[model samples]
Target chain A: MTPVAPLMLLLLRVTSPCDTGTRVVLVPFERLALPSADARELEEATRRAVAAMPDACLESREDTLARLRGSGDALAACGDAECRSAQASALGASKLVRGVALGVGGKRSVALTVTDARGTEARAQFEAPATAPGEADARAKKALEQVWSPRTTARATREPQGSRMLPKVLWGAGGAALLAGVGFGLASRSTESKLSKNGGECATAGESFAACFSSQLRKGRNQARTSNVLLGVGALLGAGGAVSFIWELP
Target chain B: MPLPLRRTLTLGVLLLASSAASAGPAQVHYALIVASNTGTEKSQAPLNYADDDGARYYELFAPRSREVVLLSVLDAETQALHPGLAAKTRPPTRPAMEAALTRLNARMAEDRVKGDVPVLTFVFVGHGKRGAAGEGAVSLLDGPLTRTDLYARVIAPSKASFLQLIVDACDSYFFVHSRGALPVGPAYAEAVKGLLSDRALARYPQVGVVLSTSSERESHEWSAIRSGVFSHLVRSALSGAGDVNGDGKVDYAELRAFVAAASQGIDDVRGQPDVFIQPPAQDRAFALTDLKDVSSLGYLLVPTGLSGRLWVEDARGIRLVELHKERERPLVVSLPVGKGYYLRSRGREATFSITRASEVVEAGGLPWHDVSVASRGAAQDAMRDKLFSVPFGPRFYQGYMASLGIPQPVDEAEADAALVP
Candidate 1:
């Protein structure tokens, strides 16, 4: 009925939720059955935490409360994305944040939901020791982190897809073979070059020369053999790739 | 580059990078490749493949040469609005060639300032004729360049320690010799003696020369090679086929022998190739190219056991190089390397690394990609008069890149403007 309410609906209907905008309306936290709490101020603490987001601009307390009061019992209590989206559409806001808190035993648990016009919603919950004062704000930070995470946004739109493991296994095997082949091939060439310059046999002049000559001969032979095997494995994968390529040939 | 003033402007895109000097290991190579198909106003017939052969030279030297520039007159077929063609847009006149040389010299000057060694080579493939004064002159796009002009312009100002001049044309022997045309048997000896007496070349310690003709004869063009007979033979020699001693290096003797063998079993004349080489106070062979150094030189590793002769093709699917391996020979032979070449033999196509890096691309690791078979005649038809013909090759590009791409430019000015970021 209000003129601004109709204008807000036009904005919400035209603009996508993907655009970065600051339109957050938080209906202050409420207890399960009490019209008002005689105890500590929990709603104000929740409001402070949600407003801390870099892209968030909270609605005036008077406007948010007046809209909530008009809803009466038909949809007075809303917790789902559809219900929250409707509330945001009417206010021409981009997002609506709503939450509840309760106490059991020595701990108090809190839950919050943030919904946008795209029918996407994210929720976060946390529990803290109720014996301490100001636990609402203390637990608010943790709950807000869960709501703002990229994974949470992805989870709302689709089922998390899992990657196939077989291709990864093949890639790992091929990469390992290539690494081993290069290492052994380099070692074989280095030793061959050295033995070509100096005689294969050790000189009588020094122990280092003699040991180096004997060591290179054996090591070079071993490396040459190792290099051949690794190269063979790499070739097998290349052949496999070739087969797949041929399958698609015209 | 589109130049507004010329009749048929050829692109001479110069891609240069200032490389760091790591003591003496790094040597900057600069090349000026010129190809002129049209002759002077009233003299010679227009050559069919002159500019294309120049492009072939550009492709061959690209992998090894760092600072490469092309000075050519590209026809409509090869130009295809290529983005690389820009700068000094005039025809290959004497002044145009001089301007190109000046730009290259200024670039190499920076390299010398950075403590890097410079090596320069001049390659010209075109018409050669005798001027009215009886002096030998090679055709430029707009005119002819005389021998005296060449000495004064190309060689005199070059500061490179190692210099090579390769000219493939009818009257090329006149560049260094006093004769107006290539000479015959005993006259060839006299010509060499005359070249040795030249004062300017004698002052240069390290210099090598390869002239296509030794006597006044037609610079024959053979259709089989798709290039002039002399240049094709010389290129064939550089492909390791000329390494008669299996020394892994193609030197002056090896190249001369290869050219002679091509004309073997003939009637009266042997193929004539002239060489004038002087080492820089060192008696090392005038090694033109190395086949074994894959890191510096482009090479392909062909395994021992491949049956039949292996034929290689360029990126355009045009067969260019060939190889045949026997078991009695070494276990592997290094295949001649160029940019974007394919190995095809017996229905099998080889895929290997051609990047300028140290990794050895083993024969065993080559991936075989299946391709649709075309008849031998179709393969032969694919070779002539093409620019960037790899579209029919195995890359099989589906034509997708960025979401918003610039449309192809319509004119030279727009083409140059599109190159800007």
Candidate 2:
């Protein structure tokens, strides 16, 4: 018993239960006063570092870029956090990481910003000087570690399961649907009002009202048709939001 | 024979004899635990924990005792103290209790025939009062049990070699002294200690008595301790914290000293419990309990380093064991420990196991309930609600328990010896 006591005690130490469930997407880092190759190298190195993190699942850069189209240049200017957040939600990511490198010649000052579903933003800035030809990867990795080291990784990746943004997505889409419906309703009302005001003009005899009356009627019909489509879509979306609310927990 | 072999044989024999004295087939324990929350109609408030306390006693004692009887109108949600006696639970009427005693008498007679010493313990966890005629009477479901009746019908007829009686209630000092119910006054408290040297109770040499009140003040209840203050102190003392000699056994004297020391630190005078124990008039300490007697217990090792008060409850939230532990005096519980045992210390709680006898379950290794992010208000409210559920609770700490013979709080270091918090 005495000989095996240490072995037995060692076996009893507790292990961590599970991961924090934070998925991150690193949008390509913007290059400033650096060659395209250097920027690409930096982004690739940082992506690898993030992918190596045991607690984070890195979203594919390609898919992120494709989804974030027109939300400003993905690398050059990542735009406001709301745009980046929307892109993250649209890309099915719980967290977004954007980086920008600023410096002339070889050395660069790189700033990395990570945002979560709860609108929480964490930024890390470090100097990543250009080293030997193959040393770029090592320097990039070292800079990333110094700024966002594994020692502090546990605190950074909270249980951001994208729960915060879920309600917003559901309600936002629902409200958008309703707004389209209201616009269509107003268009229908306007067309009806114009037709009523032009009632005598269309009814007048031999005033070449055939083409004009038909045209007015056609315009009203188009407006009414578009209004109906918008209203129908809006109603379906609102109903969808209600159904979602009844289905999933907050 | 060689000297070493002869000495070894002698030591082995002593061990066998010691085991025989406490357990080994030569002895049997029979307990009649009466936990009644409802007293006679004249009583002020019905006790909330009386029935539960009785159940807790059963949980603690029934497993090791040869035979046990519980008489109470148990709540529907009341958990069974032990599996075997759940079906045998009966109401707390005097006739039914008498019947249970009759059956126990027969069993004791059989044990006597078998040449076994029956260690009989009678526990009353309920209310008590002094009648208008000036006699101490324990309130029953039907009526008051007078002091004379207790001796005439119960104690005098007892056939066991040793008798242990524990009464946790108000005005209980009159049990055997033939004294009338004592009232609350500044002077009476001083005179109550005079009973410490009384010859009348001293004559009962064989009977060990633990009474909760020495004067009119109560045997109160405290939610922090969970059990009635008097009973909880006794139970905690028996759980090994009372072993002042560093020996693993707690006799009646040790328990008395421990209870006195522990209850002395209570801040409110009302919260002080006036405890009285009848010391044996002979040489040998009446070893009330052996902490190592885990033959029927789920042994819990509260390992070294952990200090402060700790409590355990079952899955049904029935409190099982509570003890104030210190480093030099680590506590090991014989309560039925297993999967559902919720261990609480310093307001933090966790679940632990004794699934296997070979396993030495470390107390600190268990998965604890996360209270770091939980609201302090909600936690406090929950404790308040739980405490409030027991009747006569406010009366417990509002000067109900304070009486003569109850000591004032000592320094913090001395206070740590007892269950102050």
Candidate 3:
């Protein structure tokens, strides 16, 4: 039987449902003036980015920045300056995210910046289409995906460990023990059959003393019965363990 | 007494009387054009009130029948094409319409000279069918104006000694009541005739009269005859035929004769003009002129005098309170039964009754009688006699509505939102 071990338990924790480790925050467009190749292309890029990070959680909030900036107004008084400051603060979120979308250009531009909020320099940037139609939605999705990778990868890795491993190990050990018990019980039955077949000649020589024979028969039968009981107990224990593990699932 | 002293004393007495009369009661001209029961399927017929010449002439005329403060009542809901009837999206009929009437009325009352006022006219246009067995005569849209409803709502509060009514519609004569027994019919007759009788005429310091397109038993045309009857006659008169003195402009007396001859299915034209007083220079006459032809005095008088008064009435009516003008004196009276209704001497009050028949409660708070313009948008329309201001741009409404989070009908909100921002 496999022994319950701490190393295995630690591995299970890493793969547990509760340990989806990373988080992300999306920042609003800082510069209204930006050049995008085309609105449609920009939008497509944004959609692709978000779609790529299916497991990521994206949160874009105006109020959070409003409160931080000490103004109830959504569009802050300093226009462009306010936008930049708000975007910066949003990117520097507690949750680790890849980057922030920094809007730039007069007509349209997808010079969006995706930087590690933790180790980012001021105004980290990326290049794409400028002034593309339908770019706004696409860009939003793109920005969301770019910032959500850490959390998504962590969640993907954690899924199988919690759902698959523990139940299989318990059932496999119990099944092996039950099989060994059944084989031992069958071997005892075979030995008793051979002795009985030797009969009268075998009884005079030494194989058939009544007391000894009775004791030997009783011992063999008892061993066989014990093996049968062990097999039943192991099977029951395996089933029960499997059920308990399933019930404990997060 | 010597002859010289007696003559001198008589002249002095006459001078004193003239001076005293000048400082007496204040008088103003008021007129109304109530177009209801016109059997056009919609809430109102489109541009039918305007003359064929492009200018809305009927809205400016109709005071010649008898002069006074004019109050025009148009059935906007029934006249305006609703969603199911037409594909066009029209304006909502509510406070905006009532507000226009009150504004006109108040304006007239404020800028009038003090003296004997002329007759007040209420012209109604729409489908008019005779009364049912127990249900009084009704308009095409189910709830028609009753005779009693017209008097208390229009005549009494307007303070004009004369009440002249011209109903332009098929079978408009059905509104006229001569019965001496029924509660509503007799009351309507008495209130209207009271303005004409030597007694009711004497009670007022002015003249009063009520006229109809047809007599009690006749029917008129809905399209040409009733629709353009008022404007056609006025336009002809204004075009110089009624200018008896050949001044290229028709006066009150001349226009009156013109309308008398021009009206189709003519029934009865009644008036109780004052026989005692000599005619004043402007014996309360109104004429229609083109809005754009300023050089020709080209202003079509869209139902005169009720704009300002109507505005006040609208505000008061919505609140279900009597309008009391700070500048005008209250005309209070005691009913034979129960406590009589008192006209508020301040604030604005409308004297129209909104009846929920099933509930058996008649509320005199809304603009029961109003005018609708077919050509002009609601804000600029001068249908019946009510003058409506031009509508502010749609952007203005979009911005206003956005602030309140109410969805606007126009797609211009995107552009309009920029303005508010």
Candidate 4:
């Protein structure tokens, strides 16, 4: 009885979820002018990285490609998240990893996307020198490490309040202030013109020139002051509004 | 003449006429392209690439069009670069433009009499200014072609089924639509509103407009590319890279999206060009260029497995069809088949030639050669590096279409067929 029990326990341990791990199929990396050897090396580095993860298992590239071919879907065709997820399900794996290796403009960039059967996706990108395949290999592994972790759930729950509307309101208020300033400036100019034209006539009536035009002068000065203040405020507000609007742009 | 012979001849002539009538009416395309380096005012600096841009457009459209009238005074450099094209163009004066329009309209009228469909495309690439009265005007050799003049001469006199107007210049928005009070911030929103409310343009439902600058912003030219930024993009779009859905036709929306994506990576706001594109009011799906109709141009196919920022340069070093390709989608760019061209991506380039019309060269099969790196100043690098940095593929197309609140114009089966393994 003791021997049978121990043997059954050993079998149970072999079949445990922790032992078998999660099956992940890594699709071949889509290459753009990348040397075949470098692309494969980068892919292998990524595989080693994923294998190093706890409770993670990787399917071979040959097996994955065979399944994809048999299913009549090429690796390049599975570009969207949904397609990748479907491929993952079809392969009887819980996760799929895909990537693209680009060699252009004397620079090399690798981007990886990991999608699970539940349609959750994570992406990572890294750039390395085209001459250094080793650097690219290291970066590819680092990128895999980044995407393998669970995404943070602490995203901001609500959009910034009045981020857009505030700019519009500021602009509107500034525009109104500018219009009012223009009205006041025009009034002041008109008063000055009238006073200049009639000042001689007022002086001829036997009063001092300053005394004769005091009221008109006071009105013009007050209007000019108000216009200046309003114009300054309007200009400030307009500038603030422009800065805020540009800052809020996505 | 014998009675039997006369009767037979009469019957044959009647049958021939009936067959000709039964055959569908021919669809003729006409283009009038005007480029001016000099402005009407002395303060306006002479542009370096306006004539070159016009000549490139002529090269693109001449083979496909039934008749293309080019109005430009090509400089020595431009003429040397594009051999024999200078002889085909007239001086870019108002009177020459008017005469060309008259002739095109007469031909269109004749086509109409013969029950044919005629399409007119008018292109202007040069300096433009906003007047004190907030009116927009483009420079010509004789004088400015104001918004009113455009409405009266180009739109009103056209008898075509569609009239496509492409203006690449500063303040082109005001050239196409009148502006009211100047806005404090960016004037894009105001310009669009003005365009929609313009009564003159509203009257001509067949008229479509594509302008370089949507506001008072200056349209910039890149000496590296040797063309106005917006004009180059437009020419590339018309050449077939802008056929987003692989529909073999480029529409207004596609062209707009293409230009936006191509220029989105520019970090400097001053360097960025805001484009305004509106299709004919009567037909939202009016195509600017039909690839099927352009049989004289050759195509280069960018198949799957190749991706990244790529450009095609002709033998004269004129960069055409700059785009960021994606691995999943295949793209086709049309070009003149007479010259050899190079397809370049970053450090690698491949040369190919199209010897005949309607030729499609498979770019993936070409032998690529490694290019040596050249050191450039940061400013030049910034300007050159940002072009086509954003990927133009299905994802961008889907997002753009979603933003526009319009259905994606792709046939799933056809799109799948367009993809190459």
Candidate 3 chain B, poorest ten consecutive residues by summed lDDT:
B327-336
- Predicted model with the maximum DockQ: 4
Quick one: RMSD of model 3?
Answer: 30.2
Which regions in candidate 4 have their CA more than 4 angstroms from the true location?
A1-74, A77-250, B1-26, B181-185, B189-191, B194-198, B214-219, B373-376, B406-421
Fraction of the true interface contacts (Cα pairs closer than 8 Å across chains) found in each model: 0.00, 0.00, 0.00, 0.05
Model 3: per-residue Cα lDDT at residue A128 = 44
Q: If ranked by lDDT, best first, what sequence of candidates would result?
A: 4, 2, 1, 3
Clashing pairs in model 4? A105-B346
Over the stretch A1-250, how does candidate 2's per-residue lDDT look in tens digits? 3322332233234121222245676766544334556566667777887777546777666544543442322222222445445544444456667664433211344556666544444555555545445554565566555434332333344554554355457677767867776786687677667668755457664677777777777777777777677767767766776677555532
What stretches of model 1 exceed 4 Å from their correct place?
A1-250, B1-25, B80-90, B132-134, B180-200, B214-219, B239-249, B262-286, B290-298, B303-311, B322-421
Off by over 4 Å in 3: A1-250, B1-32, B36-101, B112-121, B129-142, B159-164, B170-177, B181-212, B215-219, B222-231, B245-256, B259-421
Docking category for candidate 2? incorrect
Error of 4 at B118 (Å): 0.9
For residues B1-421, write the lDDT of model 2, one tens digit per residue.
9743553454345334444544445556788988888777563487777776777777656545666788876664454434434466677778877888888888898888877777788888777877666677887788877788777767777787777888987777765455534445524433565654453556566688888773433337654434686787677666555654433466776676666555544544555677667645552367676653323344555533355556776676656665555443234455553446778765588887655221234463455664432344643444333321221111222232263344323312321112110
lDDT score at residue A131, model 4, on the 0-100 scale:
52
lDDT minimum window of 10 residues, candidate 3 chain A: A98-107
Against the reference, the lDDT scores of all candidates come to 0.54, 0.58, 0.34, 0.73
lDDT of 3 by residue, A112-180 (tens): 333333333122123443335455655555445544444333433345355546567778877877887
Predicted model 4 interface RMSD = 13.5
